[model samples]
Target chain A: MAALRQFLTLNAQILYWTFVAPFAGKPTVRIDAIFQQMVRIGVQAVPMAALTSLSIGLTLAMQGSHELARMGATSYVPDLLSITLLRELAPLLTGVVVIGRSGSAITAELGTMKVSEEIEALEVMSINPIRFLVAPRVIAMIIMLPCLVVFSNYIGFVGGWIICNFALDINTTKYIMRLIESADMMDLISGMTKSFVFGWLISVISCQSGLAVTGGAEGVGRSTTKSVVLCILVMLVVNAILTGMFFIIEGPKG
Target chain B: MSETKRETVIEVRDLVRKFGSRTVLNGISFTVEKGDTMIIMGGSGCGKSTLLRHIIGSLRPTSGSIKIFGEETTTMSPQQMEKLRLRFGMNFQFGALLQSLTVGENVALPLIENSKVDPAIVDLVVKMKLELVGLTGFENLKPAEISGGMRKRVGLARAVALDPELLFSDEPTSGLDPIMTAVIDQLTMDLTQKLHMTAVVVTHDMASAFRIGTKMIVLGAGKRAGMIIAHGTPDDIRNSPDPEVQQFIRGEPDGPVPLKLAPEDYIDRLLGHDRDKGLSY
Candidate 1:
């Protein structure tokens, strides 16, 4: 119960600093800090996100082809792979990857700062720590996560095409046509929407854990571990709920 | 008697703080006049640091009134307190320099954050403040690259960058050698005197405390913990008759501080028994 209350309070604070407070003329958000975080959270994360999505795409194509061939419907491989990657796998896998990568990194960085008294130093300087330290990272995550998901979706589709054409002996022209025909804009939109929420969740959870850290080195390690685990768990649950809601609103595709 | 007519920069009345059931600061009260160098001295965990934090508005007192420059800080909102903090500077024990930023950048942080200063002017001020702390030409170096003494100097530079009316230092000489300790004490004295800033320092170092303090207060330890057992000038504190104050000032190992536990209590602790009769171990 305490944890829930803390989560709600943290969420509200982050939202106020990032969105509402700026509109109210506070303008506490630092553009330079946000850009720096974008480089760290989004630009540096491309290779890892791409590799994970590509591998998942290849595995999905191979497994889906095997099952479909047994039913003599092997040509449906492109449709299955594209639809899954676009609607579910892309956002979910991207979120998990970032949770381990940037979420844990954010926790460790801020946790170390807290332990070192840098955050308290900021407070003493009369700088709002939430605005100076947290809002930028949260904004970066919100902006970058969807872009990463979109990149992942594109790469995953290409990986699926390679597998369907080379490994499964499916024609390239047919695979591309089937994928394009099966998946629509709504599939992409829904996945991107989930990615946005996942990004927000990861940033908020990690930053809150970091800010709440006590002790010293041991506390930072604990907060890092907790941030990663909580991000992944919450993203999974939120993904499930979002998927259901999106399904109802947009209806299932393909 | 004439001191009462002087302007009070900080007025702390019956300040109290508690962590759960354990009261860290009892009903403590004191006043710091303008240009006064008030040193808070005590052994470990005597609430010296806690008191400094309260005066700086970093921690809230359980039941007390803290007025800074005649403004009631205990009842101020965070935004109001932030504006109030601009007139004061605090030097933390461990330096608290931002590791990611270079020394010059760290020193210039206040001006940049609070005021719309030109970048060139900011650099010049950073250079000047660093030089004031005798850290000239060390501007480009990160905090991790500097020594402990150097980091503390940098923290001092950052603290005084804003030219605040009041200054607070927490254990400025804690981990330094005697020479460095004296250097920091001298620097602190020079800065306060030169800038005409009211200063409050928390330290257990009797030598540093005596050197820098015009007025002093020593916190009592044990059951009388957090209570101010002695308050006077440097000479008065040096000649204090209170056993606790004398024990602390003389740095005696075996005095009123109680170095050894009683035999019964020692045995009970060793056997994992509760000190109180009704409590289970």
Candidate 2:
């Protein structure tokens, strides 16, 4: 019963501070801090994200083009790559990369700080830890992850194009032009929207799991694991929701 | 020591903190007076740090009150607690220095974070605190760059940055080498006395506790402690015949005060039938 009460209270506290208050109060988060944390969480996350996206684009295009040739529909292959990469693949891939690179690292760093009493030290020093640490991370992700997603979409499409056009002897201009025509404003918007939701997913889940850490080194590790798993799951869920909204009924008109 | 006399600075009453099904601190009570350094000593997991957290209003009690300088801190609002905490400072075991900042910046944090103090004044205060702990010119160094002893000192500097009336330290020398431990102990004593600040330290360090404690509270076993146990000067605690005090002070292997384990477990361990004994080596 006591354990239940503690769990409820801790949960309530996290919800209140993390979600409820920020929305309710119209809190003015510092712009400079947001930019600074973006450099830390998002900018620092680039290398890993780029690697994952490149590999995903290469592998998927190579296999996808093989199936296209077997169907005697090699020319239409750009459409498949276009819709798949933009509407599903690029955003999902980038989301996973960010979860591993930014999400886990943030959780571990903050968790260690919590265990070491650095958070308490901030409290005693009249500094709000959430404002100084959490707010910036959230703001940075919201601002930068979409831009990163846009970049990932570009690179991944190019990755597929390079494989399809050069490696598979497809007409280069025809493929690019076909992709540009088939890929409407909605596909790009949906892709960008996925990035936005993913950014929120990564930040909120990671910060929560990190702050949940208590005790020592083991606790920090546990928090980091939970953060990555939860962020990825949430990102995938949001991805599914966005894909259904943009692609299922609207088709080419969207 | 300069006509050593101090007044009651901290008054704790019926302070309680519970973790899950077990109540760690059950109606614990104590007082720390000004110019007096009180040590809260206990066996590991004896709720000493819990009690310290309660005093600072960091951990709210299940039920009870803490009056620091006669203000009822237990019921204070978050803002009120922040205001009240300005009167207090803490040094935690891990030093708690902001890793993003240098040692100078870490010390300057209290001033910068709390108030729009003049940059020049903040610098000087940071220097004064650093100098007090014999840290001198190591300001630009980050916590990652410093030794453990130096990190603890940087934490101490940050703690006293605000010049708090009541200073609390949690296991100030838990990880340092012996020489460093002694240096920290002497610093706590000299600084506490020199500054005329009231201090409450939660520690398991017998020698340091004996050396620096003007008043001491020994926490013993219970899901909630049965009592705060012995209370008085360091000599008073050393001479105490209470089984808990004797066992803790002497670092004895066994006693009437049940080690934080169940009766069957204790007996099995005592008879050497158990394969694993965590606290008992």
For each candidate, give its TM-score against the true structure: 0.94, 0.82
Q: Summarize candidate 2's per-residue lDDT along A120-200 as a digit string, tens digits.
A: 777776566776777778778888888777777777777877888788766778878988987877777888888888887
Task: Give a tens-digit lDDT track for model 1, residues B1-281.
Answer: 26558788899999999999999999999999888899999889888988988888888999999999999999899989989988988899989999989999999999999888899999999999988777899999999999988899899889988999998998888888888788778878886788778999988888888889999998999989989999989999888999988888888898888899989888887867754666655
Pull out the clashing pairs in model 1.
Answer: none
| Candidate 1 residue runs with Cα over 4 Å from true position | A20-27, A252-254, B1-4, B263-265, B272-281
What is the iRMSD of the candidate numbered 2? 2.4
For model 2 the local lDDT of residue B244 reads 70
lDDT of 2 by residue, B1-281 (tens): 23555466788887777788787887777877778888988878888877877777778888887888888987888777777888888987778788888999899977876767899999999999999777999999889998987898788888889888888898888877888788888878876889888888988888888889888988877432635788888888889988778988999877776547788787777777754546464
- Which regions in candidate 2 have their CA more than 4 angstroms from the true location? A1-33, A70-72, A168-172, A248-254, B1-8, B20-23, B118-120, B173-194, B204-212, B221-226, B233-281
Which pairs of residues clash in candidate 2, taking residues 3 or more apart in a chain or in different chains?
Answer: B9-B33
* Candidate 1: residue A186 Cα off by (Å): 0.8
Top model number, DockQ? 1
Model 1 residue A58 CA deviation (Å) reads: 0.5
